[model samples]
Target: MSTPAVRIADLLEDVPTASNPPAPLPAPDPGEAPRTGGSTLNITVVWGDLTEVAADLHVTGHYQSVVPAAAELALDQAISGGSRLIIKEHTKLGWIDAQLGEVTYFPCKAGPVRSAAVVGMGPMGTLTERRALQMYASLLGEAVALGHVESMATVLIGSGTGNLAVSQAARALVRGFAGVLALLSPPTPPPRLTEVLIVEVDRLRAEQLHLALITAAESLPQLRIAPRLREESGGRLSAPSAAVYALAALARLAGPQSTPTRDGPAGTATRDGMPEGPDRPGREEALRTVLAGFDPDIQGKVREQLAHLATVDRTDLSLAVGGSVGEYDDSAQVRMSVLSGVGGLRWAALTGRATVPERLVPVDMDLLRELVNRLTEPSVEDARELPDLLSRVVVPPDFQRLLTDDARVLLELDRDTASVPWEFLAEIQHADGGRHDPLAIRTQLSRQLRTPYARVMTDALGDAPLRALVIGDPGDPEKGFQLEEARSEALAVAARLKNLGVEVSLFVGAANSREPGVDPARRLDVLRALLSGRHHIVHYCGHSDFDFSGTGRRSGWVFADGLLTAQELALLERPPLIVVANACYSALLGSATGLGRQAQPSGAADRSPWGNPQAALVPSLADEFLRLGVGHYIGAAWRIPDKQAISFAEQFYTYVFEGGPGEPAPTVGGGVRRARKGLYEQYAAGRVPPDIAPNPKRWSSWAAYQHYGDASDVLVRHDSSGTTGGS
Candidate 1:
């Protein structure tokens, strides 16, 4: 199994036994996990660095320490828009303990394997910007495994580690995130290099990349983009191609702009070679010093990241951007990196005689092991395990929330652990949230969440108007509840955010009764951006609900065969502050099991969101949302009046943003708990019952359908002095 300097056995191994003598990377202080300063983001600069970052808004994760600041910049790339902290239980050997029972486990079935997506490369590392080019090889390799992607995008994870200059990081990312690598200038010259390296790197990188990619495209049966580039040069970086892994790395290292765009990013040097230096004068030098002279370990790290890319299964149809935040620019880099890196060698489709690697590689066995271990843990209430000590441990709700959500998990585990947003969790409510542009607030919040999740989610969004996605059609204004009401609300909200001077854009899903073509997984990219703290609220009124029957009776439930469950969602790896699903019967469901069998809610029994009081509704949408670990969601009990639904949403949103500029709602579940309390009370009193029918369990003790988590916690309840319920 030993192949080369990097052993094949070692290269393909998973993390469980793929242990390294990691120097103790202490967790940031509990309170400091959310703070920008006095936290532990400084060390990652060496482990892996984010190249194109908004310093004012982002806390560059360092492996060691974090600097403290009162009004910290929000995370740029997070799910649902901006960043929020995901607090997972990180128990080291002598350090923290994983509350097994606290986490949800999915069913272990040797199910039909689906093609993996090839997110070309966003391989985060200490490597130089050049790594982006290398990352393509790995990304392309994955494309071969994945077959294809429904759609893809990228984010930017700038390089701080490695030999990468910000300029080089930019080039690598363009090919990496957008498939559109353009020239960029450093904030300032490297302390030594007077020229902006991005200038030299961008064009050469793109041209050389185009050559390599064109050649690869020729080898491929299909492409992720227009045929123009692929049709020419017939695909070749050089007589020999740029390594797919390198191209993948370029994708990983590039800083992708996160805004949703119809046209891809293209660049030409301005009259001046390139724009360098930050708007601010003196600090540019300091930032450049850090960017250029980062620890050398980072370079090796990029190599590792690139090498890792080679092992992933790639798909032709699907294009992905791989890299940390601040490196990938957006979807373009992800798409482009695939074309440049592995499109040529990749199989045309998943159907033909796909070439398997010479080795017999199993799927991520360790992750599977972790999954099994957590799933089989003795349910807190039911203890039938051999040992009492290893019984599921109790964890706080916050940690539980992080375990369920993808954005939350990334925030909690990535190097930027210290800069994780605590305030976002505390202020997860919109007081009078109505049909206004909830996207603004959501983006704002997500900006904080994106800082660490696979690189900043919003890093690629750049300075564009916000893009929004609504369920109704834009042309047929009438017969839709989202015309003037929602649009006006959107404009007004956008204006307020304008006062704060943030960029935003909006896109809405079509109002189809079915979740048919919509891939909730695709929401990952969008959600990652929201988690970045760029988007504050994600408001949607759609017709959907969880199919609790596990039979999946509901029609048009679109999900990958292998999907995350509500239980897993409960463990928000990186929690998002505000998530609003305003529609009929729309509840989160476990993609893995179709029902939220193993997941739990963020609160107490009455407050628990797993199963309802009635076992019959075990797979109810509410339960699914709870399991999926959504932070704050507002859904209709059943079908509700559309106009009324819109009204309720608008009113609710207004309440949340009542705070002044840059002042978000408190994350301690204050706004959410408070508003929901009123809703529950009104429903209970039968005073404000809507057209929707109420389930009997709604009247029972919030704890009536409750289950206990480990004694410690498994919820996202922050330091709120609110009413507590359930067991």
Candidate 2:
């Protein structure tokens, strides 16, 4: 399968250009001669017969379901065995079933072109300017893979049957071409493909196309755009130029060339092509860092910190270690970076670290499943071997060196490395026949997202009155899981927040009633509206599900209306400072074997153990919240029991609003740490509620609570006046 294109910035035009020719081609009256053309850095402008242009490959196009006149005669004769063979293939596959925005290659039989491609436009009369440009770009990529080329030629697409204005079409096409070129060659490497010759039918249209090239060249100064316009007879053709002058622009753009323009701050277009920030690393260096098994930013920071730590004598040491492992193609192998302070920081040769073992123990799934089943039960087997298995799988011997009897470490992880249950990493077995808890439980350990160093100092919401929105299940009790426990949990949290002087808005449906309350159907609209303001916190208690059938897994919350997917949530420009999703598997991400399936309408209590075999394996809402830029996110990775969740929430809020032991106004992580400790304390005391029996499994539930942002960022603060304050 082809790699998906990196996200394209929204269409833009205000890019700074290197000096272009003295004057832009004069604009043409509709259907007049082509406009004038200009030159830039690397991209050259020229107009001539496309059939006669010297290039590696030639590209043409046809509508998704319709073959226009331009592609009928000449294109048919250019391909091997003529157009009849192509027609037969299309007829057998059916037009609608054929791939869109793709190129079908045909070796040149009796033409100057070495190879030719017919790109598919969606449909006649239905193509938008954006679609046309995007398809053209994609076609170029396909042609490169087909011909293995360095140069190419083609006519302007989307201008003929699509009836696009010359100027607008040219701009779109040029942008598409420039975008591809940027992808192929950044600062790190020069492109393999060198030049693209665009042949226009008329001087007027060619000039318009050249003008667009000039604009693109200026905006993408990194690209060496040296544009020039010419006539069919090889004479210097000057005048107004049109943007829609070449079909091969995409293919040409795909050649190695870095276009340094980026969408500026706040999604605005910058006129200059230079990247933002003084510390921006070179493109090649960044790519190399990624290939070296870590995020470029994190790798740089880790390298610096490691060097410093080697000289420090501090007992508490944080670590960010990474190495190459696994297959190059798999993300799990590609991103092997792990940021951990749990049990302190280990000293290892950073270049070649151990990888997570494919399997930790010699056992069948049944045995593993049994072990999982017994985790919450009091009579659980002495699974001190759990940590041993984990250590072998992920932790290297050097990791143990960093450990102390009492180490408070924060473990940061890339998305792939985050999948491991680090909370269960510990040596339960000792020479004295005593078992140890996971390093996390033994130490003040927390998991955080691995972000750039610059963002680490970002403070939490200083908005006074700590605004909060609490939402609960709106699904029908009979059709969906009965969220009675969820509703009660929401109510309790809201009450606690309100009592603490927090501005809390509660949205929960009445128990067992299908009444309208925070309708899930309108989740997108509601979220857009709610997230628009500068709220300090957002909390939700509900069911969530994931779809894993597609290339990319999608996750959403179960609502009365529908599953509110993560894609919809991404629409918010400003997310709350802290998001506490008190839902099952809220701190997880979708995985192939995890919660990749839809939610089954089981009427289990809110705190029922997330018994689904796949539940523990997926990414949760907490991850999504963090990705969306929620300053602090708290979530549970497993099905948390109602009492435990409520207790944790109450304890967390108390820590944030009121002084706890030493911390007067605790950060979100601090609150979470306190709540988890409280749960652990309760578990150790065998203080299981009357309904549930005392078991080790009950204590293990605390491990599910996860925080995925800066640990030092306090959600709220309080002054000596005993009033809650914002921080």
Candidate 3:
């Protein structure tokens, strides 16, 4: 009679077993076909506990007794009285002196397998791909020598405590198995060991390994490996769905006043066909329950985005500080996470708390206030002192170390810390021992409002033509509030966007009445345009105000007719995907002039119409827009000079709409970083016009802008012809 052919297969899911202390494998069928020669060996990868797999022999790795906990320890614990039995067996057989790659076998009476083999790996944290491959090859060779071994089970050798990447470990393991198979060619009858099973407890790691094995198989066709993955129950929620759910919950928790009250059944539509607000009583709790139904780790939703950014050699460092807005407490707990990946197969995560020093405490609120005041006024002397003040106040040594050159940082802060211009935080030192550059100039850095809810949303203009609405110098020049440079900026940006195949809608104030599609910038017209949802980008170059004493109702941009408050913008049915408010104090989260006080710019009373005792600290225009589901919000943290503002807009638009060949696609964060870098370079070269940067020492307008969104967000997906250009 001929031996049965052995077949090699990789199973991506765990084998089904009946309860713990699993029953032994059923006896081989008597009516089955007799064994045949030229059979292939079967290899399976599964998501399961190693102790539960039913096999003739089990394999595990140990660190030569250097580590107390590892795969071997787990296996020992799973077997009844396994620790004492294994120790006694080893002592009796003198297997205690096993060296690296040496496997010791012992009889098993209480475990799922009839026998177990322990291989000695090197000391803890010393395992590498090469070592793992060699060890696994030796193990398989020894297992084949055991005449009665029909099946064996093992864990992913170096992926756990050994710290090897899932892909690396999987690749090494497959190659090692192949090495043993090569020794016994087709003519030689397959050994008694016809099956090997790799079990992993983590579903994600198992999935990764499944892919890696398939990838390895693609290169090794002779292996004839058939990879199979069984669908697991309870998958994760999509990023857009999770973001929408979280935002809805937040809106519900904001109280009935924030959302329109409902009179009919839940989810009923209003007169305009829009669903009633998310303000139903107990609705927030219901939403929270639904959100919890999925995996609670929200960060998993953005893994794809992080992975995409990582392809360009960028890492994401998100730091979220806990506290309410407008509360300037001495200290707050900060949660920081660093995410980076390589070759699209490996990802590294580092999570920890920000360690603040005692010497930097007692934060000088006054100094922060002065810093904002000087930056708004473009004061060179005061601006030059910012690096020292911010370093001492917020950026501690530990935090500074996290800001690596390739890091794309996002700072989520409450109102207290929000007022500080984090972009202006200087680096500790430059490689050439030159002057340190600000954080924004050195890397792609942005900020977010640290609320209990996450600010995630889907891109409204997915794969659509880029349509922009540019509103410049909305205030009439005769009224003394018009910005001449802003008028020029809007015209130039509109022309540039049009050249890049963007649908442009230009609206200039009376200052540039003849230079646009619209005669004059009107509030009603602008609102109508926004409500039409025809535009994906809104560029407002004008004056804006924030009411410190009142709610966000009074915070908005000044128009030719009146001030368009944030409350009105928030009520829009369809907000633009991106909003660029190149106006002073457009992004400020808190007031530097104290509650119930307004910081009147020198001669502001003459040029501005929106004047008053600004009320209590309220959300800025940027915050309101972001809450309204705008994908990206770019606004000024303070007053930016008109010339610098135009220059920034030009550079920013160019980076976003135009890209050179062979360069990574432009991202919102990348564009902002490039713009800032351009400005810094110009300053360094003394090329910044004197009129724009009157105080050479304070030529830091490049740091005045702030972004609030995912830095990897792509604004223009493609050009007009549907090519792969503007992604």
- Top-lDDT candidate index: 3
Top candidate when judged by TM-score against the true structure: 3
**Steric collisions counted per model:** 290, 61, 17
lDDT of 3: 0.56
TM-score of 3: 0.49
TM-scores, one per candidate: 0.24, 0.44, 0.49
Order of the predicted models by TM-score, top scorer first: 3, 2, 1
Clashes of 1: 290
Error of 1 at 663 (Å): 7.1
Note each model's CA RMSD in angstroms: 25.3, 23.2, 27.4
| Residue 693 lDDT in candidate 2 | 57
Q: Write the per-residue lDDT of candidate 2 for residues 1-727, one digit (tens) a residue.
A: 0111112221121221121111121112222222222222144555565656666777766544332233332455445342134532342234322233656665566557676666665433333465555665565555444546777776666665554655556665565555555454435354455666666655545655676666644544444545445555432222212122121121112222332222345223233222322222443454344348777787677555544443432212223332221111101101113532333222111111122221122333344334444432223344345656545444555455334323344555644334445555565355687654455544444565553321212233443456778877655455544577787788788889888877777667624463354333235444665656656677778776654544455555666555566567656566687777766533232322234343434432122233433234333455565666666667666666678888889988887666454433455555776778677766667677643454345446676666665444445444335354443
If the candidates were sorted by their lDDT against the true structure, best first, what order would they fall in? 3, 2, 1
Cα miss at 493, model 3 (Å)?
A: 1.2
Better of 1 and 3 by lDDT: 3
lDDT of 3 by residue, 1-727 (tens): 0001111210111232111111121111212222222335677776666767788888887543322233465465455242124532342223454344667765566757568777755433345565666667778778887778998888777765454766777777766666666666677777898887777654444555666777765544335444664333223332333443344334344334233422245446532233544554565565455456557576345333433432221011122322121111111112222211121111111211112221233334455456544544345665566565556554545566655433456665443444455677665654576665665676677665544332333334445577899988886454456677778778877887787778888888853444545557877888877777778889988777654355323467766555676656655656787888777543222232232325444433212121211211122566667666676788865555666777777778887766445565566777787778777777767787777655553477677777875564556545666554454
